[model samples]
Target: MSSRNLPDDKKLIDLQRFQLLVNAITDYAIYMLDTDGRVVSWNAGAQKFKGYTSEEIIGQHFSQFLTPEDQKAGIPALALQTAETEGRYETEGWRVRKDGSYFWANVIIDAIRENGRLLGFAKITRDITDRRKAEEALRLSEQQFRLLVQGVTDYAIYMLDKEGNVSNWNAGAQRIKGYRQEEVVGTHFSRFYTDEDQQDGVPQRALLTARTEGRFEQEGWRVRNDGSKFRAHVVIDPIYNAINEFVGYAKVTRDITEKYKAAIALKQTEQALQQAQKMETIGKLTGGIAHDFNNLLQIISGNLQLLSAEIAGNQRAEKRVTNALAGVRRGAKLASYLLSFGRRQALDPKVVNIGRFVLEMEDMLQRSLGETIEVETILADDLWNTFVDVAQVENALLNLAVNARDAMDSVGKLTIEISNAVLDENYARAHVEVNAGEYVMLAVSDVGSGMPSEVVAQAFEPFFSTKPEGKGTGLGLSMVYGFVKQSGGHANIYSEPGYGTTVKLYFPRSTELENCVVIQTVENIVGGTETILVAEDDEQVRHTAIEMLTALGYKVLHADDAQSALAIIEAGVKIDLLFTDVVMPGPLRSPELARKARELLPDLAVLFTSGYTQNAIVHGGRLDAGVELLGKPYSREALARKIRSVITNSIQR
Candidate 1:
């Protein structure tokens, strides 16, 4: 058996078996190229992976598989030269397959030299597309999970550096830690513990336990920025970077004082059982109806916008489209009112100098009240910043002005006065359920027919509008009332039937300075020529998107489903961005499709559009972090801006 490694015939048989084994492997495309990098030898595996038969690829250059960008950059030539000179070359990149779609390929090339003379090179490539997609999916999932944890308002969530310095803060963290992100990051996290705990090295012990045991949990008292102490349930989890290197700790602290008291108080009986049942039923009904109605509206409204943009030069058609849009807007407002009355969300409150905000709106108010109305602005000296939802505040002002106009028969004297006000305990007692605090007062008054005492008392009640029948939806003042109360502020209406009406909205003062506000002027619509993939199941909606994007100078590829979209991606059409519907058919959802597409083309951008988010990318009525969402019924400018923004970000990437 060891006689010079067997006879020559036996050796030839062994080599043939080896060749068959190599050619039969389907998972990897194994083959050989000539000295000039031309495909000279091919196998079944190569035929399956490269979408080419031996006859088709035998004389083709191996560089054909490289992406356009790679080929343009001379990567293929360098790969061959490197393999021939350096003995071997190995790397990963996008490789074109038979149908022209791309796949993430792990490739290797070895120089083949016989008798000290260069012959050719042996090349091997494996499709790692699924592997790459899985990794990307995991990354996006982790990011969204982090966003969900950070967006928690009931817990103080933050991070500390390895040395126990605070490095991040969430909204809840700021509310609990009594510090802004600028004040907390880079500071010692030990400040969250009580003085006694710090003295006893609790912070150090916590970090050590988290690092060693994986996590630390305890109940303790923590101090706030106002030098106040509050009981909290705290947990610290050790964070590690890739390769398991120690990074820092994720800290989550929950305020349990009010929660504990509420649990105890409500343990025995449900006082609002009937009321709660009614509201729950209403919410469910409203949600179901809204989803269906909004879906139809999305198709109609979207097409209308496209049509309007297309018929911009036709006078009658343009006028009709404008009227149609107004109707759609009214319907949309009604839908908003229904949702607000059912499952309303919290106000995104910010500290704003109301004085400046009012001044900016003066021109708009003048346009609203017409020339007959005298508008006056009495701004207070040394204006204080108050925390409130700026948009809702503006809406409230506009509502009051309109009501004042209606009361005055479209002509009256309107005054907007801003000043500082204080609410003492006495005032709190007079206004039940109101807390005493220093507030920024925003008062709107009009010398018109005023409301009676009874009418004023019920002004803030839902469905209690005093406007003539067919004039209002009755949600204006009600919305204002809810906004003020939810913001930890107060709204008071004072009126004399014969005199006039004055509404005072008090927003709690804040220590933070006012943030600068930007006023955007109308600008010409921006367009792009980027290639966009539009994946939508609805034909009308898909058509509208294609038309709108095409009108904006973008080249669009349309797909009716996620599978078809992926097919297009796999076939390797050059795509700049993926504009997909968040909710789609089949197992390959939009988010998952995005992951797969990104695997094929890492620089490909993604934008999600939906009529209703339906938990696809929106969490708690807010878009997830790092996600760009364009809600249904968007205009041309909105679409252009979002697409352009995404493409710009991608270019930088």
Candidate 2:
């Protein structure tokens, strides 16, 4: 129905119903204000919100509900003027209640005009303090979190978008990746990976794994902005929103280059220690076997020599005995090589300038290598002195030269370099068996077919040879290794396929003056007429020794062990010399027997013989001071010379 046709009473009832609806709202203060901003009408909601009764607040200016600052700024009047002219006004600010308390409020004003004439205005206000406080707290928490992430410097923490592009970077990310935040943001995260890694889709796989499995962690090489690479430990976690939807990834990376290198060095050292232990075990077994074999060779050699004397003038018999003797000598030489590899042979060390010694042997080395091999010696001007067995050094050099010649297929340059070297702690740490110290380095290099890593690993092992069977005994390198180690030195070999090979021996430097003593050769095997006491554990060795000495015109005495020999010495027997084996079964050791026998016979001469000294009369691979020693498996001539030499030296002393 049209408003003009409706009854006045019905219109009044409709207006009253609208008032009741507006008054029922308890959350919003609903009221009316005159054009001048005076409170002309108030509702129940206004009384509840402002803590005021209708009688107390009626006719009061609406400005009374505004804060003092807002009232002074004339905001209430402006609000009313805006509503009258523009029809409506809305704002949010602090408003005061009747009790003088302020609350954050949302306010609105609407003009109620009749026929374009000035009229009152309707106003509404809502308390919004709790919501404002919550929003403020959230903003503060986000700021603090951003600052925390930016302050870290040890780890690269960053955020990636859903498509793996960098969204945000922290200070740690800038420091570790060598890039500024402006340079990294909006770029693909794959740029931080190596080209190989990127080609393998490692970055994408990491993101996918994190998205599917919740997290991904790995260690690998990472490229920085400057293009340098480092070992990195990385972790990726899929970021999720409050509703559990995947947004992106949170990546963290740490540089672990030094730690990774240290781990690798430790592993290499462990492998070296294991190899050394294996070699040591093998040395012990070979040493024992060689010792026993030497004893048998000695007996056989002695019997053959005696047989040769019996078959004098008989060419056939003499030739047969001579061939047998040659066999025994070869067996003895084989046993000696084993002892050398085992580091069981006694050494006669002398201080020598290695450069001069090598120069003197240049002619011999040249002749040994043949015309096909070019020999070159690079000796340092002021090379250091080392205490070592001169004969053994010569042998070691010859062995290395021959090996180099063979490696070069008999047609390449062989270089021998001698120089002073100092090994530092870092080298010692990487090589477990090496000691950090000054050393005289002897390096031999060859331009030949190099060895692979597997072959180089077992190069020093006895019987491990690359040469065809029967072409090599395989003890050349092993003997050199043992001799260097026994002389308190280190041996190392470097080789690569198709390149070349170099073997370096580092001998401890010595401060002693060089000794150039010339050893006189005994051309004639002369016998002596003196009482000689032979003490040996093996029955055959003892009997053979007694017969040989008796044949040499000496009154020979025999004893099964050191104790028996000592008893005979204590019985006041006038003995010119004591020939005793170093290793015996009796409680009275050979060394002790020698000491006691010398005490009883003040002018007695002593000679020690051993297939194995077993550290009894040898210390640090050298014979004890003032002790005379003769190695086992000696020929008749050698036995005669050594016996006579000892007796004459003892009588002279």
Predicted candidate 1 versus true structure: per-residue lDDT over 75-132, tens digit per residue: 9889999998899999988999989999999999999987789999999999999998
lDDT of 2 by residue, 158-238 (tens): 999999999999999999999999998999999999999999999989999999999999999999988999999999999
What's the TM for model 2?
0.83
User: RMSD in angstroms, all models?
Assistant: 36.8, 4.2
Q: What is the C-alpha lDDT of each candidate?
A: 0.81, 0.88
Error of 2 at 363 (Å): 3.0
lDDT score, candidate 1 = 0.81
How many clashes show up in model 2? Answer: 0
